[model samples]
Target: MMDSLEGEELCYPLLLNVSCRGLMRPRFEAILLYTLFSSITVLTVALNLMVIISISHFRQLHTPTNLLLLSLAVSDLLVGVVVMPVETVRFIETCWLLGDVMCALSYIIGFTLTSASVGNMVLISIDRFVAICYPLQYPNKITRSRIEVSVCLCWACSFLYNGLILKDHLRQPDRYNSCYGECMVVINYISGTVDLVFTFIGPCSIILILYIRVFIVAVSQARAMQSHITAAAARKVPVTAKKSERKAARTLGIVILVFLMSFCPYYYPSLAGQDISNDASSWAIVSWLLFFNSCLNPIIYAFFYPWFRKAIRFIVTLKILEQGSSQANIL
Candidate 1:
């Protein structure tokens, strides 16, 4: 019994030592990789937060899609704030130094936010498809109340789905630490597998299908509008309407492209059964790809919507001028 007690006492520190192994090396190449990843992660999260703050501070962005975007921004921000910092330190440490409780909490938060982000995207795609394909019906179909309901449902589903972690049967007599070093309890394999399938694989598949349908509808609508424009011109109809339709199509294309590019990198490895490793390069790349989603949201907005650029520019210039005036006053 004394030996067993001694063994239990050693487990915690031994785990820490194991987690920190090889982490202190200052290898230039490894540093470069992780540094690059960390920079991108920070940049992306920063952009996400900036956009969220800007929209909240100014009420002009209260549209349904923007509201959904806000939800996504919040989720991504949590990943950026709560998840990435710890993860990065673990990367540098080369181990899970924090223990089981932190590990469980991090995993739960990361997974939930990620689920919400992807889920919101899917909902947005569905919203866009309806707006583009059935403009007249869209107003009646997707009212503010409906949007709110959908958002609530999205969040509720996310919460309940992740809440299954409560049912996880794993007893961490040994403190849980993530591959990265945060102390958290690991869910047993069965629960973990179930959560992964339901949260990641299932929603991802649905999103993929929805986007595919959305693209098809968008392309068809674009072609139909073009033909209609040609006929309208033949009949001497106003050109402004046609111009608006063309612009909308282009914006949709850009949004779809950005979404695909940003998400594909993060999902591909997981779907492919690729091993995640402590190799600094792999961790760096994963970090970049994941946090990069947060950044791309605002960028996609700015690129696809002229109004977003105007909002961002106006906010940025106003801040700069305000800061300059404050400096002059101080001097």
Candidate 2:
């Protein structure tokens, strides 16, 4: 009985000498953390799932930009479905119980999804810039086929890029673990900094620049429309089109701003090329913050869209399951 009790304290009982210790916190504290993380994981999956259903089920929700959003939702859904739960298990147990292959696969999947989401956001910003600044060319430049191709490229690049990031670890999954029952993949500060710049900072800067131009164009168009209301009825089509562009610009701008705010702190270490060691005391809390921010995304993104709201109503009322529901005029 004593041996069994002692073995429970270590992640691997038989290999006690080299095994990492489990979370030794008070039982209440451990339970609390587990419950909280579980809630976040479930909420993330539920919210992103709704987004995926809303976009995919509604024919009217299909657009170049919504397609990009659908891509993001898919990635974020996987983060919740695959990444968050894996992370939660790792965090609560404070041990890598799933073995070496899972450890490597989890990080690769997480990074790829995150990187792909950023890529989709960049594409969204470009789409808005063209739609608002050069309305005449929007349709030709941001066609359905082109957007589909871009999304495919974004995901493909993400998978390829993340694989390269962890190539060494992939080759030898146990390479960095200091002992049995431990799971770790190390990225030297230089490689991490390079990743930070390429995957995060560079993309954010591009998104900001594009959105700024979009905002300027949108504002000027708004003013011009305000001054020409006398003939608004005569030029209703162009005016409506411009108004829709402005609304999309404004709403997506807010979404991008929120994204920047929540994710900025997570990447702040990149500026100093700081190492992200799991052994750091702040790892649990800091990592937990990321999931908290994720839940806010569906709230902010969906709040701005009437079409999304309509789709939610359908989904909630179970009308979405009705035959021919996809033909509903959601817009």
Candidate 3:
């Protein structure tokens, strides 16, 4: 009876000696958690996929700003497709059945995509700052080729940076595993601090500074435009274009604010001088909160863009499949 009871708790009953113990949560609770996270994963993927399809299919949406948004959507999609399901299984099952290699790769991929997403946000801020601050130079400064190069560099740097951050874990995938079936990655306080600074503080600082400048310039421009635009000038289309740019800047501001809120809790341990561990008791809530940001980005950021609304209509109605849909007026 003792042997059978031990078997019930062990992840691998046959290899009892080295097998890790599993969670003792009731079956119903585990199922409920699984169902909930699965739904989130699906929603995140579906929403981000819509953004991708919308931007990619419509020629009018092929501007440099949308290209940055496209990069962000791709990263968020990977988070949903790769990171969310893996984490859900790791947390709910409390067993790392996929083995050591997968354990390492999963985190590497997750962190890289996350860093890339941050980089994309920074680029978006810079794009807006240029547009709002120097309207005449915006087109020349934020070109498609320049944004493309910047995006490629952002992703490449992310991969390299995260690889260094998780070098030890990648080198020895089972280094932190206490027993078989366990998956744990611990970032020592030193590494965690460095990560917090680069991944959170540094990038966020740049984004904050740029957006502040953008906001100041935007306000001045708004006031000037309002005072200077005569009824005859307002009747022309030029005034409307400037107003549209201001609206987009406001929308992206909300995206950055949500990004900060989602990220702050996950780094709280580091803030408190503790090493970051994936297996911590509080990890579930904070980590899922960060992942939940991926689901919210599309709704919060893209939903405000009128073109996205119109694109979704075309897509949902299958009108996007018709000939010359790629040339459709999305903006």
**TM-scores of the models, in the order given:** 0.70, 0.87, 0.90
Evaluate residue 312 in candidate 2 and report its C-alpha lDDT on the 0 to 100 scale: 87
lDDT of model 3 at position 307: 94
lDDT of 3 by residue, 58-127 (tens): 8899899999999999999999999999989888886778989999999899889888988888898889
lDDT of 1 by residue, 204-280 (tens): 56656665666666556655665665653755433554565566556656655665665565445445555322242
**Residue 220 Cα positional deviation in candidate 2, in Å, after optimal superposition:** 0.7
Candidate 3 Cα misplacement greater than 4 A, ranges: 1-8, 229-253
Question: Per model, how many backbone clashes are there?
Answer: 19, 0, 0
Cα lDDT tens digits, model 2, 1-331, are 6665563577787996898766466789879988988888898888889999998988888888889888878887888888888888777776788889988898888878888877877887788789878889899889999999999999999999989888887889898788878878777787688788878779878988887787777777766766666664746657676776767577767766776765676666666678656666666665556555556666765657788888889999999999999999988
Cα shift from native, residue 222, model 2 (Å):
1.4
Best by TM-score: 3
Angstrom error of the Cα, residue 65, model 1: value is: 1.5
**RMSD after Cα superposition, model 3:** 3.6
Please estimate how well model 3 matches the true structure, expressed as its whole-model Cα lDDT: 0.87
**Local distance difference test scores for all models:** 0.61, 0.79, 0.87
